[model samples]
Target: MALTVSIVQLAISVIAFPIFLLHFLGLWDRTCKKLFPYFMEQVTKSYNREMSAKKQELFSNLQDFAGSSGKVTLMEIGCGTGANFKFYPPGCRITCVDPNPNFEKFLIKSIAENQHLQFERFIVAPGEDMPQIADNSMDVVVCTLVLCSVEQQEKFIKEMYRVLRPGGAFYFMEHVAAEPSSWNFFWQQALKPTWQLMFDGCDLTRETWKALERGSFSKLNLQHLQAPLSWKIIRPHIVGYATK
Candidate 1:
């Protein structure tokens, strides 16, 4: 019986590994967009229900900090689909960077519809390689739920820090590993292989906030919220602002 189970597990892993590699390389985004409308629907639904609230709160707080500072230059790394468009401060000049070249059309169209919005630029580049933007030119840099998918979190954080002027803020919300518990630890260990496969190399067990804290931030205002589940098992979220 144990031998049969082992064979089944091996078979599952063999099937999943290639799919996971495709996801990591971003082939799944184009291939699955049509077949995965339900996936997109769930993403949109989750954004509208859970993520929108968080974005509004974080943006509002960041806006207040920006205060009378006129027309702040805002950079959003990994601004996929421009979903955070509605939450951007009025009169803010925006520049978006994403590794996917296909994201350009959506970003351009979104900006065109909003007359108040002005685009400084859009570059098809990773967060760690934003060469076009000058150093310390941005007032705000926003990253939302993107850290886990980044190949080098440390490099990304350093790039964010390098671009921001002193006193500039980094607003972010990211999913992270849960607190240590027997069941949670077990789930993290067991499900990570499969979870990373489907989710573009996103590891549920990454201590993303701890990594941020260790990075070169001047002021770190961090808060954590657990998702609706066994708190130690699934979807632990950390959201906050860090200053450079």
Candidate 2:
């Protein structure tokens, strides 16, 4: 039985290795975006209703904070299909960056539909490397549910800091590993292999805020919440207003 299990594990790793490698090279975003609608449908169905409500509340709070600052300039990294479009303030200048070229069409459509909102531009680039925008230029940087899938979280945070103007805020919402619990830890470890295979290297056990701190933001305000589950697996979130 042990030998058989070893062989099976080896085979699974062999089959998934190429996909993982491609993910590291930034191919996964394109592939995932192509299938995003289908993925989202399944996720929407499976996600707990209360969890969704909490997320909505989080966005509401973020919007309120952003709105308080008059005519803020915003940059959203990994703005897949502009999921947070409705949360942006009406007169704010917004720039969205995503590697998916297909998102541009959706963005244009969203902009056209929402004539009241101010949109400055859309750039096709990975968050880790955004060359088009100058340093200390943007007033606010927003990232929602994107850190887990990024190839280099540390580098992305640094890039965000580099581009943000002095006193600019970095707002984020991410899913993370649960706290110390036997069952949750076990499940998280067990599922990581399969999850990485299917979900573009998004690990369920990453400490996202640690990576953000490494970026050297001046002020960091963070909030953490857990998923409603028996296990210690809190969807360990941190919503912070970090300064550059």
Best by TM-score: 1
- In the range 55-160, model 2's lDDT, one tens digit per residue, is 5665554344343456778899977656666666677788999876666776687678677678899999999999999998888888876888788898898898
- Candidate 2 lDDT: 0.71
- Residue by residue across 11-111, what tens digits does model 1's lDDT show? 66677877766777988656654333334334644665656767778788656545345777789998766667778878878899987666676667678
Q: List the residue pairs that clash in candidate 2.
A: 178-233, 178-234
Give the runs in model 1 whose Cα sits over 4 Å from its true position.
Answer: 1-42, 65-69, 112-115, 182-185, 228-234
Error of 2 at 201 (Å): 2.9
lDDT of 1: 0.74
For all predictions, the C-alpha RMSD in Å is: 4.4, 4.8
* Runs with alpha carbons beyond 4 Å of true place in candidate 2: 1-33, 41-69, 228-234
